[model samples]
Target: MKTIISTKYIKNTVLAAAALFAVSATAQDADDTSSPFSLSGSIDTYFRTALTTSDADGTYAPEGASTSFANQTGFALGMANLIGTYEAGDTGVVVDLVFGPRGTEATFENDVLNGIINQAYAYWNVSDKTTLTVGRFNTFLGYEVIAPAANFNYSVSYLFSNGPFSHLGVKADFELSDDVSLMLGVMNPWDTNDISLTGEYSLGAQLGLYDQFFNFYYDSGRNGGLGFEVDYTGGFDLSDSFFLGINAAYNTNSETETGFYGAALYPQITASEDFAIGLRGEYFAYTADGFDDVPVIGLTLTGSYSKENLIIKPEIRLDSWGNDFEPFTDNDLAPSSSLATFAIAAIYSFD
Candidate 1:
């Protein structure tokens, strides 16, 4: 798809942001009391292919799959991310930019270079326990993140695919106690990072709890009267080298009476400092008033190898449907009830 914004505008924005970032870094270096500004990010690329013979389009995944990072069977650029962070006293800011296929798809629904920015936000510490943040920021809903370096699996879950990616507005976070915290915010309508087409806003909140072995996060939000979504994420350390994580989400749109609900489980084992293996199992269903629910289950096995600043992830995924509600393409030139895919990605990150 064509970009909504012109190339000249994007170029101008990039130049302006670069100048601002340079100024901030220099000022921070000159100020004894200010925290240092940091530049860090990652670049990722991958080769993905469908293992099944049924895919005629060379894309084996189901329609509307969230992690459609490598739809075609070939090598693809995942993303190149550039993040700048600066903090001084009680004020801080984060500027994140990205390019490539995954970045464009995740942040702009496949619109090419509409704007290469992922997030630009600033925060102020109102008190020792409270902070107020404004501008565009990643959503608090999912356990997985947009950054490939942060995820155990290369592909994203259905739950993450359907939830909000970022919010444009203001929010306040509070540390309620040593193990509990809260966040509340008002954001532009769902999925519109730059503007609210509806001219309406959404309400967002999160409750979190954590200790040595367990962490939990719960969040819910609504876009005016349209609909609401809730998500929960939890993680527990099963052992020094083993961990378990869970995620569940539900969303409903009042106008269309359509929505989806799903959950996923992650189990990971770290064999050493440089190697780890993980599994993702998920079940998802789409629902409406009179229609029969279409359900799908997905399983993915992934292994990651780390060396210095580079990490390599190799993954295999299989998806199946209970009924004949087939949406996957197979080489058979007919709708298929299942699909299998394999991918390997390399992510290089530095600061």
Candidate 2:
């Protein structure tokens, strides 16, 4: 049978494959060391095939239904952090510099400059219970995150990272107890330009419990707006060799124009020390005053196997969005009512 493919998916697949290959080559030339100046990286690649249909196309069939061969891929590379000691070890200073290709860069036109520096930050350990960080850093919110497998759910939930990438400012984290902590910071809000907006700023705080089994974050900006997020995670052991877990989050912001909020539930079963299976379901919605609200719903089934130096994952996903947003069409404008997509992906990690 013949298969159809979308140009966008094809391009993404090729890029992902290239990133994976680069990571593999680099890892083979590296050595593991406990020295402060260490290096580590991982590569991910996947082929996404979709079967699309519309009423205008008559009977629903797989023929000519966009087959994305090797569509989505990427990689991440990071270096060992330096923790500087001061005053007879009474205070410690930590610095981290990280960069990566593919997803890390805003654009991937030329391979040479595609890997831009994504993170460069410093931290000061004020005490066992308090620490301060400055410079560019990832936001501390949500139960699921950009990190692979750290979240039971596959893909990204609207509540987890769709809003902003990083915050450039100062932050303080304080531990209230073994299971509770708090974080507060001030920075430019969302996608604001590096320069301050009329001396405007965004203030944020997070309350976390038990390594983030539950957490809440709030950000208030000078522009008469507020953003909030809540996350939760829980797991139970079914037997000696099997366990199940769930993760979920919700986010909302009041800028009054196209704000995002969503939730996800994942049920995972561990088959062994290095293998697992899971199902993920999520719903996300974006609302704006002058436009129709856009809602996206998706489901994914995933499986993985891993060992000392190799890890592999396979997943199938389906997504549908409300009419307000279009999907894969010539028009770049958001749709008005509905769109749907199906995809399959795989990844391999080595060190």
C-alpha lDDT of all candidate models, in order: 0.71, 0.46
For candidate 2, what is the lDDT? 0.46
lDDT of 2 by residue, 139-212 (tens): 45443433342333334444454545456677887778876777777777653424455555666676555444
Candidate 2, residue 305: lDDT? 66
| lDDT tens digits by residue: candidate 1, 1-351 | 110111111111112233322333333444455445777778999888888646656655545643546566678788888888877878878788888877787678422357577888887888988888888877777667677766778888877777777778988877788877777888877777876666577788777667211212222324444777777777677777887778888878776778889988888888888888889999998888788887889999999888887888999999887656776766667777888889998989876
| Cα lDDT for residue 71, candidate 1 | 62
lDDT of 1: 0.71
Deviating ranges (above 4 Å) for candidate 2: 1-34, 53-101, 105-115, 149-154, 191-198, 213-255, 290-292, 322-351
* Steric overlap count per candidate: 4, 14
Cα RMSD for candidates in order: 8.2, 10.4
Q: Which candidate has the highest TM-score of all?
A: 1
Lowest summed lDDT over 10 consecutive residues: which window, candidate 2?
1-10
**Model 1 worst lDDT window (10 residues):** 2-11
